[model samples]
Target: MVKCCSAIGCASRCLPNSKLKGLTFHVFPTDENIKKKWVLAMKRLDVNAAGIWEPKKGDVLCSRHFKKTDFDRSTPNIKLKPGVIPSIFESPYQFQEHSYSVMDSPKKLKHKLDHVISELEDTKESLQNVLDREKHFQKSLRKTIRELKEECLISEDTARRLDVFCWECCQESTE
Candidate 1:
């Protein structure tokens, strides 16, 4: 019997490929066109669920196959696809779990929106207060202008000073 390593193209049989005795395995392509050639080359190996033989080297197989050498028999555990089970919302247990996650989401969003609205309301109130103060200041300014004009009528120098002050006030207001 020609001895071969489990890996691709070393030709040196440095170690035993199979962990157990008498059972040999190899991986081969499952495609129908290539299956016959693979089966013919690796004679004693059977295809597993994945169509892989235990000791596959690249795409080809060595003549010697991996065989069961130990008394302990181990089989691969198969897993089902996630989609095979119903959607999370379908089962009551799943629905509750999903609902809990969704429930947590909107609460934070609602809180943030509420906080933003409160901030906006506070800003609006502050702006209105500022506008009210400005209106009162303007009314007091008009009264000061009437008093200045009355003082200007009493003296020409006072009239010149009042004219200068009025022009400065008008320029500042435009700015």
Candidate 2:
């Protein structure tokens, strides 16, 4: 049986007589939670709300809505990791035009700010770890240099005493 994309405004359809090759429809995940998340994401994109938003067993979301990073494309067959939500959408104008208006909502602004703050904290922690490692390496290098210098001084003192003793013995033998 032929299948078609169920995403809103998508006109893709699969037919037996079609000349196009390698076009495959991906069914929504069977897991109820995952399916619900996909439905929520779709609802966000559907400005018109033309039809029932719920997805059923046969409903498919085409590859166009997803980014390359969303799928594991290394193998022959494309696969999505479990719990991965499709966030990328085709409407750039809607986001660009209404971004400020959307951000004006207090709850959304707070949520976005919280996300940014969390990311900044993670970066700060990582940078601190790197600095701590560098400090440890510097301390070890200084200790090694000090030990080597002490060894060199001791060797020099021993060689000097040996040279004096040999000179005295030579003078006594000559006499």
Candidate 3:
């Protein structure tokens, strides 16, 4: 019943723990080709165990191996999309030292920082625009409700006047 991340370096267990919150375990794909692809990818990560063992149905890979893009998150519960494969891995370091060599150079680090700041500013602007649109919609809805109430009042007043006029005319004709 105990589930743990199948990734070689990951120690994430699927037990209820503060650190492991939101983590999910995924079963190996049922399709033969996809299963083979997953097994190959796992083998690549576990170089020592390569070609030694094959993954079966009961074997599971944890969420850490996948990027957010790898899963379809439109539904309440996230699901792996059909034909999509997990390529990301949970290594010891957050990022591989060789890949993040830009951090070692002052100029490259500054450029990366600037790029991150620009992205953050763009995201903030986009969020503000969405909030403004929601406020406008709420104002329009309130105005529409007020207009409907006024129209209803006018309609009731017209109907009452017509009824009184008919009563007067009927009384005169009877006289």
Question: Model 3, 4-65: lDDT tens per residue?
Answer: 66666678776767234867778888898998787667644334664445665577888777
lDDT per residue (tens digit) for residues 9-78 in model 2: 5776766643255455678988889888887776544346665377667877767667667777788887
- In model 3, residue pairs whose N, Cα or C atoms come closer than 3 Å (at least 3 residues apart or on different chains), thus clashing, are none
TM-score of each: 0.31, 0.42, 0.44
Candidate 1 weakest ten by summed lDDT: 81-90
- The model with the greater TM-score, 1 or 3, is 3
Which segments of candidate 2 are over 4 A away from where they belong? Answer: 15-23, 44-52, 90-175
The whole-model lDDT of each prediction reads 0.47, 0.67, 0.69
Name the TM-score of candidate 2: 0.42
Q: Tell me the RMSD of model 3 versus the true structure.
A: 18.9
Give lDDT tens digits, candidate 1, residues 14-92: 2364434332333354555555544443332333554544434444333233222311344552222221211111122
Error of 3 at 141 (Å): 87
lDDT of 2 at 45: 40
- Count of clashing residue pairs in every prediction: 15, 0, 0
